[model samples]
Target: MLTRKLGNTGYEVGAVGLGCMGMSWAYQESSRDDDRSVDVIRAALDLGVGFLDTADIYGDGHNERLVGRAIAGRRSEVVLATKAGLVVDDLPTKAMHRDGSPAHIAAAVDESLRRLGTDVIDLYYLHRIDPAVPLAETWGAMAELVRAGKVRHLGMSEVSVAEAEQAHRIHPVAAIQSELSLWTRDALGGVDTAVAGPAAAGAGQAGSGDVVRWCADNGAAFVPFAPLGRGFLTGTLHSATFEGSDFRAGSPRFQRDALAANLRIVDVIRAVADRLDATPAQVAIAWVLAQGGHVIPVPGTKNTRYLRENAAAVDVVLTEADLAALADAPPATGSRY
Candidate 1:
């Protein structure tokens, strides 16, 4: 239930924000189970981790609607952030694509607002930049959303420093979300420059000590998603049970060769977990939290059992020695993408 200021946006959210993509789509094909999904979302709010992240492209807008319903009566108690720019709406061929043109952002915000069932979105992000369109034009459209009072803040995802700077010229970027984990480390100095970029509004992932320090010094709130490493760190993924259509199924880390080698990393984590009398998932979550007081890790779970265990991470604390041991784990075998 800890909190941090996202840059100087004059708004604050739970240090960690929930990524609702997997709830509706992406990662793996799954049933809707709106009732259960809603329950998990409310549970997160009750725990005070209220920055909910969703996108229009997720489930063709189902994710936003689910998030919208979850926060219906209790909207005021949570910080709602949804995104646009990734076009997943009833694709004729069901192909994934980008759409950051000014026209696309303009039209998408209305739909996101309507689907989210909110008057004003706390934070709106361009899920990814469109190579065909300029970033400045997209940010300009987002700036218009702010003017119309439909959006309060704007941010970008998986973008470079140059792109971020260009977008900020039109409007202040409130946050940046990219994949940053212990194993999927970003290019060194990547986050430092990102957090320090003009907006300084926020940088999404600072799950490591080095990244967190950069965010704090640069005035950016770090929000880490997939802090559980998509169930690998949870100790439920063994080589035999890992073959599936899920996102990790294709992950190099989950491949037979890489997974075999990666087990050693898990072994080290499990040793720490046993010492703390916690699950490896909990240990992983706790370690991310310990990276910095400002870092927030959102570990998603569809089932209440795992949800409860993950929530307990707010109490688990790793010592300096523990951190050093974790840092010394053998190098992972494959690239994160």
Candidate 2:
């Protein structure tokens, strides 16, 4: 795998990092095997997909513990990143709310550290801003973690450029992780991309500005979560019917009519993939990589086969025609909740 600098952290991680959320949360819950997930994480490290991302809200700390177990003996080989701010309300329903209050953030870091089994975290992100709590107080708490040596760098997820600027003044925003893929380009700006669901009230509003450009200009890495459009751009999903527990089952874009309409976006990706002799997944990830050199897309997968496929996306270069086609692909139908 090719490497890219992780913001100004002075650390170069694989251009394609691993998102460990689905292993323990938000996906096929019935098939979630901790042992298999551990193997996949270890395999990721072997493939140099060493920038591992997780969050305390995932599985209500189960995901962090699983990641801790996976990297038990080989922590040095990974650039571990985890998050705080969002608290899981109901594990079964995956309901959650933001708790960016300084007190919550203060307690969350120690809990995350203990679960991750690390003295210090390489990168820590504020999963979502709690509208109830002031961003300054929440961010200031995170900056304190950096000073206390509990967290190395600070980042934010699903935030506007204005919010990033506000937090950056308090502490350097090493990265900003948001939903960015061939279909969802909200992070690039010029779209009404407010996040939906429990934290929707606190989600960044539309016209958040060009966050991708903001990161580039401000010396921060743009980390795109769900870079494969939550597996829609992979061209592997032909049905809108998902298991009740699956996150996609309830997502608007994954609903029947919307999904049928969204197939046009996948068609464009598949066409580009066919031309390049690559899988739609690879083409989708490659398009995200094309957004900027500082952009790193973390397409989550619990399967090692898919992990290898995603890791290989770094080499799937897009041509001018491919870029144009992907850029002109129809906007995704339905909200990104």
Candidate 3:
């Protein structure tokens, strides 16, 4: 596996990291197996996919516990990262709200540490900036955690460039995680504001520039979450037959008519994949990797095979022709949310 520097944190992690969201929450809830997820995480580490990402909101802390258990004995070999700030309101519905207050940050860090079974978190991200709370106050509290040695680095997820600058002024923004798939290019300067959560609030707004480039200029790593377009870019999601508990069931893009139209984008991707002898998932992940050296894509999966396949994307190199075709690929038919 290829390795990349994680911002200025001085930690070199695998280019393709692991997102543990689906193993405990969001997608295919019925098929989730804790034992299998644990194996997958351990296997990820063995493959040099040492960067692990999870959040407290995921399964209401279930993901963190699972990750903690998986890396219990092999903690030194991994770069552990997790998030806070998003409060789960209704577990069944996956309804949640943001809470970025200092008090919330103070309490959440301790809880995340306990759940993760680690004394110091390598990277702690504010999952979503609470619109109700000022960004500085929340960021200032996170910096305090770093100073106190509870957190090694600070990160912001789903934030605009301006928001990042504000927080960076208070404390260096080590990393910025956003949705940056071929379809979701808002992180690279596209103007699709219908993204999920607080990330959408800054699209097309003043001071919110190309966040990916901003990270590179500021010496911060840009982590792309959902680089697979929630498995749609993999060319395996042909039908609109998602389970009730699956988040895609209610997503606009997964609706029957929209999904059929969205297949055109997948067609272009598959064509590129075929030419390069790579899977559509690999092409999708590789495209994100090409965005910048400071860019890292965390494609989530609970299956070990998919994990290996995704990590192999580091070997998939896209030519200029392939890049042009993908850049011209049809815009997504539905909103990212």
Candidate No. with top TM-score: 2
Model 2 lDDT tens row, 104-223: 999999999999999999999999888888999999999999999999999999888999999999899999998898778888886955565554533555677799999999999999
* lDDT digits (tens) for residues 1-337 of candidate 3: 8899999999999999999999998899999999999999999999999999999989999999999999999999999999988888878888777799999999999999999999999999989887788888899999999999999999988778888989999999999998889888888887754544443332223234699999999999999999999999999998999888898898889999999999999999999999999999999999999999999899999999999999999999999999999999998888767
Model 3 residue 191 lDDT? 78
Ranking by TM-score: 2, 3, 1
Q: Give model 3 RMSD, 1 decimal.
A: 2.1
Whole-model lDDT per candidate: 0.71, 0.90, 0.90
Tens digits of lDDT, candidate 1, 160-250: 5566667766777667666555554452233221232222222232222344344555455556667776667777778634324365665
Report the error of model 3 at residue 16, Å: 0.5
Candidate 1, run of 10 with poorest lDDT: 193-202
The lDDT of model 2 is 0.90
* After superposition, candidate 2 runs with Cα above 4 Å error: 195-204
> Which portions of model 1 miss their true places by more than 4 Å?
89-94, 187-214, 240-245
